[model samples]
Target: MKKKRPSLQDVANQVGVTKMTISRYLRDTSQVSTALRSKIAIALDKLGYIPNRAPEILSNATSKAIGVLLPSLTNQVFAEVLRGIESVTDSHGYQTMLAHYGYSSEREEFRLASLLSYNIDGLILSERLHTERTLKMIEVAGIPVVEIMDSSSPCIDLAVGFNNHDAAYQITKEILKSGHSKPVYLGARHDERTIIRLQGYEQAMREFGLEPRNICTDRPSSYSLGCELLKEALRRYPDTDSIFCTNDDIAIGAAFECQRQKLRIPNDMAIAGFHGHDIGQSMEPKLTSVLTPREEIGKVAAQRLLARLRGETVTPKILDLGFTLLYGDSI
Candidate 1:
């Protein structure tokens, strides 16, 4: 009889490394060093073993990886967020795993537990208070946790994000100063971040004695869909002069719709966004938004996790990296 195929376990047996490290090499995650990669390559060649690429990593041996849970990947903003998370995770020799929750709390809860089943080293969560069960799970996940973009909640482990309440308050206040009272909020979900941003907008509008207009939180994939939503908003609330998207991607889409309507940006209708991105800047009128320290967040989150892995003390003081407001033509 012919010899059987060598498994990841067989390779691990030969290489003196974890099966998870072998999977990291197979996935091309850049978490392993060249020496280990070469060793794995030699093992594969010698044993004629192939990696299984089905249904993600199957066990905790494979799950010792770094898991990044997010709303979606189509958005460039999220891509940057991933870059930030990966940049640090890579530097520390941890493989990166990914899961998309589709901006749903229940979905996040499911994926969170699924990723945890793998016994990942740490987790980077995009939204907070997504679901009741997710909160419960976080309370006992027993690993390093980092919440990005919205850090209002009492995160169990680590947090590297902005004060959405303050960011929304400041941006809304600027819009009020520029003479626009009826600004609709565009967002993907009504999670903790969205609630805070909406609250801040309401707080500012009330401070200026302006009744907050209709809060239409429409979630869409592309420009055409956003255009339709904005068109309806324009018809329903014609006095609405400015638009504030929860993130820069939505703002860019809203701007496209504004362009299609033949509206001069910042003149006929001013537009602003949050999470300043290069895509936002590449537009005709550079997006006036908040530049969340993405790279810094990633680097810092990684450092924090590494410190914990190294048994160092981390506190809330240094973890508070704030946000900066960027003003532009659409102000």
Candidate 2:
């Protein structure tokens, strides 16, 4: 009732050759004569044969793949970063397998362990924090690994990203310089990057002799969270002159909420966001924010890992790409 799946032996039989010869031809075309190779190719096409790599992978003990772990799949920030990684990997004829841990270290551990079981050649991780078992697994794997998006001390191999603290501090100081002294910091997600940015904001506020007010939540950042954070900030710090958000999602949401409340942007409450998302610029008043080099960090991290894989030396393992302060009407 059903057609049988073609096997390597079927292709070999079709070409009047032994399975071993066909196997050698599949592994390396040079091993077979040109005429025989053409015959094998024709037979494979005729049989609709597919070469399975599982056996080869088992024998070679290398998957010829890169495992990439990201915190969020829907975020454009990570999409851009993935693009940068693929730009390098695709050229090198390497395949990338992606997994999302949803910003959870425990889930990240499980996903990473599963990837390692596949014997991937390398790994690119967006999150810095890892469980002890995750750390041990990586150490045992002893492959080229890279940590992207945020720099951390005692990294596995390479750390590539901008300094979140400095970026937040510089941007906050700019808002203060713009005459918004009573600014509050709003954040969500409570990721390592969020905490670092909050620290920077707090440091800037203290340095300016102003008390820092932070209204934050552990929930993942979103447009709705932005609106809610602003509402809470307004409720508690009624005299808040400005708000520095952890990311553009919240900042843009705050802008929309301000419009609904008939609050004049900047004149009524200055707002700034980080990550420099395109939507932030589309707002009526535009968003003032910090633009971190997310894609560039991904590209550099990939290049570094590839270099190590190729037996090339990688100098200065930790790379600080830095960030830009986008001056706009919101601040």
C-alpha lDDT values of all predictions:
0.76, 0.89
Give lDDT tens digits, candidate 1, residues 1-331: 9667788999988888999888878778488997887887888888889655344544334344777898877866677777877787777677787999887778899999998777777788877565777777766767777777655667656787778898998998988798776777665555567678888888888999887764455364455545665777788888788877777766788888888788988877777788888788888898889888877777777677767766788887336678989988787
Task: Output the lDDT of residue 29, model 2.
Answer: 96
**Residue pairs in candidate 1 whose N, alpha carbon or C atoms collide under 3 angstroms:** none
Per-residue lDDT tens digits of candidate 2, residues 1-331?
A: 8767798899888999999999999878999999999999999988888777788678866677899999999888999999999999889877898999999999999999999888899999987789999999999999898998775455778889888888999999999999999999998888888999999999999999999999989998889888999999999999988999999999988988898888898999999999998888887788898998878887888889889999998878888887899988998
Give candidate 2 misplaced runs (Cα > 4 Å): 1-5, 11-50
> Weakest 10 consecutive residues, lDDT, candidate 1?
53-62
lDDT of 2 at 66: 94
Model 2 / residue 242 / CA error / Å: 0.9
Using alpha carbons, what is the TM-score of model 1? 0.79
Q: What is the clash tally of candidate 2?
A: 0
